[model samples]
Target: MTTLYLLGSAAPPVLEISQVIEDAQGRGYDVCLGLTPSAARWLAPQLAELERLTGHPVRSEYKAPMTADVWPRADVALFAPATFNSINSWAMGFTSSFVVGYAAEAIGKRIPLVAMPCVNAAYAQHRALDRSIAELRGMGVTVLYGPGGFEPNQPGEYRAEGYPWGLALDVVGAMVSPTT
Candidate 1:
């Protein structure tokens, strides 16, 4: 099975993560989820349910080095609703959490990485976001942003509209199976 690392950050769309997981599964991917600490807290009520969806525990904190990794090696990675912190931290190689650690590693490990940020318009204007996007793109991570991917919503208000969840999955699908 083609394993996909579905990494989530503390963003508005973390609430709808299960739908994305199911979407990935529908595309024949074996999904593995890792969330930032804050995201984990937000999804606390759904962790067990998420495990059932992926058949693996959702990992947030770093396990001891000696501990066995329950999830398989990822063939590709998707950082959905990737927050401003995650993008900056990942580009700067900050790995305080499991998701960021895995994301940081994916660049060098040469596992295809795709990211879609869900930052608000004001925050998206930060210099760090531009630099981070450029840096990650320079390293071959597929950033789903700009005009097509994630348009920043106004501050204090996320879209009451649905997120384009399938766009990320479509990008990953194309990456994983180009001929398809």
Candidate 2:
């Protein structure tokens, strides 16, 4: 089976995460979602709905050691609605959250990966975000940013139509081509 790890952050676009799952599945991926702690809280009300869509758990916390893994091992991973905080933290090797933790290790595991940032223009201006993006790209993660991917909106002007969930999914499909 072609399994995908769909990771989300607590960005505004996370409210419409079902689309991300839908896109992944449409591209023939068996979706498994992981949320940052804040994202898990934000998406709490829709946890069951998300589970229904992915047909798997929406994991936030680390599974207890020695427990059988609930989701299939990832053939590819996509991190969307990737917040400024999550990106910076992951780049700095902070694995406090399941998504970041997996991403940190996925690089070494050679898992095909994609990341789509949901930062606004104001936050995008931060030097640290640039550093983080650069670092992730340097590590061979396909970061979908700038034109044709994700573009920062003006702060406070987030429109759901503007998020690039589709772009992230498309990149995933390409990465997994002839993949299984």
Candidate 3:
């Protein structure tokens, strides 16, 4: 089974991550979910939903040293609806939380990682965010979505809400496509 890691962020798009996991499972991939603390507050239902869909617990944080071993090796790691905080934290090498920690660990292992950042226009336009994006890119992370041009204000809503199927398909294609 192809192991796909779904990293969460503090945005409404994080809730939609369950749909992505369900779609991936339909395409015959096993999905695992990891959520940021703020993202967990916004979409608590996703934890249960993702567990039901993937038959695995949704990992929120690394509570103990041995906890990391329980996770399967990921074929792909995608951070959808990535928050500005998460982007900055990851870029600055902050791994105090589970999501950032796991991301760092995955990168060290050379896992094929992708991030889809979802932020409002103002946050996206921030100079710090821009620099962080550049740093992440320099670290060889594949950013899967567009630049921060659009804004989606409500929780559980997205500026590009209609394109989830396309996003999920893109993730699947990336996982299976051969690298030169």
Candidate 4:
């Protein structure tokens, strides 16, 4: 099975990540999860269960220098519910958070990458968001934004159930499948 690195940020939709992981598993992926520090804190109570579900540790911070990687090599990475900060940090090469840090390096490693942002309309209005999206796209990262992807919701009107996780998974599935 293809190893998928499902990375997430501190967004409302992250609360439903268990379903996303199960959905990916249903599509035949060996899922390993990573998260931003804030997201990890948000899901703290369920971290052990999530690790059990994925059969891999939920990594939020960087491991020790000489330690071996816990998760298998990722065939593809799907970063969803990417917060505004995470996106900008990744595009700017800030490696503070393990989620954004891995995503930034994944570009140079040529790992197939897909990203979907979960930002409110107010946050979307920031000029940096557009620039970051464009930068990620230029780096060969498939960003699912705009009309066909994640549409920003109004401030304080988070619609967690409406997050397009299936769309992101579909794209990742296509990436790892053999195309005739």
Candidate 5:
């Protein structure tokens, strides 16, 4: 089975990750969940259930050196509902959280990567976001922003139900498809 590292940030859409995981699994992926530290804290109550659903420990922090890995090696990584901070940090190569760290290293490892941001319109206007998106793209990550992916909504008009998990999964499907 292709192991997909389904990573997320603390956006409102992160709350619906269980359904996203199920959707990825249904599409023929062995999903492993990773989240930013803040996202892990936000989903603390459901951590165990998430672990059970993926059959792997949800990771938020870096493990100690020489420690063995808990999840299968990732065949691909999809970071969704990526927040403004997470996007910037990742582009800047600040690997403070396990999710960003793994993603940064994945680029060097040449692992196929995809990301979709969930910034509000106000946050999306920040110059840093554009630079970060471009930087990740330059590094060969398939960042699904703008048309056909998550579009920024008005500040405080956040709707978690509107996140584009299916679109991200579709891209993942193509990446993992044998024909591709």
Candidate 6:
């Protein structure tokens, strides 16, 4: 079984991350979600729904009693709608929350890490953010950004006509696919 660790952030776009989890579950991948404190405030209801749909718990802290291990052993880890703060924190080795802690643990184990950053152009274009992204890349993390020029509104508020949830599912598919 392929394990997918969905890391959360406080950014508004994280509200839609459950859709990606739901899509992956539909494809028969075992998915577990970890939420940051801010992310829980923005989208706990949606996270609850995802848990119901996926039949798995949504973890916010490491101490929470989970059915099984949910970190380090995941086949793939995706931090979608990652906030600028989260990008820097992860790059700097700050693992305070379950989301950050799980990512850090996964990095130690050399698990595939994918991050889709959601931030305004100014923050996204900042030198510090660039350096963080580069640092994560150096560590073999896949960083995905939305198209340039188009600005997304505040988190949990922006809505694209047809968001690319399928692409994320494709990535999960590839991560879970068996080698012949």
Best by lDDT: 4
lDDT of 4 at 90: 95
lDDT of 5 by residue, 1-180 (tens): 889999999999999999999998888888899999899999999999999999999999898899999998989999997999999999999988899999999999999999999999999889999999999999999999998788899988956568889999999888875221
TM-score of 6: 0.81
Q: What is the lDDT of residue 164 in candidate 5?
A: 84
Score residue 48 of candidate 2 by CA lDDT: 97
lDDT of candidate 1 over 1-180, digit per residue (tens): 899999999987889999899988888999999999999999999999999999999999888888999998889999988999999999999888899898888788899999998889899878999999999999999998889888888888856666778999999988996221
Compared to the true structure, candidate 3 yields what TM-score? 0.83
Candidate 1 lDDT score at position 83: 92
How many clashing pairs in candidate 6? Answer: 2
* TM-score-better candidate, 1 vs 3: 1
lDDT of 3 by residue, 1-180 (tens): 777787878776565676777777776667788888877777775567667877888878776755456567778787776778888889899987898887777777888787777766667667888788788888888765453322434444445454343464575465665222
Instruction: Please give the lDDT score at residue 76 for candidate 1.
Output: 92
Tens digits of per-residue lDDT, candidate 4, 65-152, equal 9999999999999999899999999999998989998999899999999999999999999999999999999999999999999999
lDDT of each: 0.90, 0.89, 0.72, 0.93, 0.92, 0.72
Residue-wise C-alpha lDDT for candidate 2, range 15-40, written one tens digit per residue:
88888778767767888989999999
Model 6 over residues 1-180: C-alpha lDDT tens digits?
677777878865566776677677767667778888888877766766877876677878777475566333578888876778888899999888778877777778998888777677658567888898888888888776555312444544545553455665566566666222
Using Cα atoms with residue i matched to residue i, what is each candidate's TM-score against the true structure?
Answer: 0.95, 0.94, 0.83, 0.96, 0.96, 0.81
**Model 2, runs deviating above 4 Å:** 178-180
For candidate 1, the per-residue lDDT at 105 reads 81
The lDDT, on a scale of 0 to 1, for candidate 5 is 0.92
TM-score of 2: 0.94
lDDT, candidate 3, equals 0.72
Question: Residue-pair clashes per candidate, as listed?
Answer: 0, 0, 0, 0, 0, 2
Model 5 residue 59 CA deviation in Å: 0.5
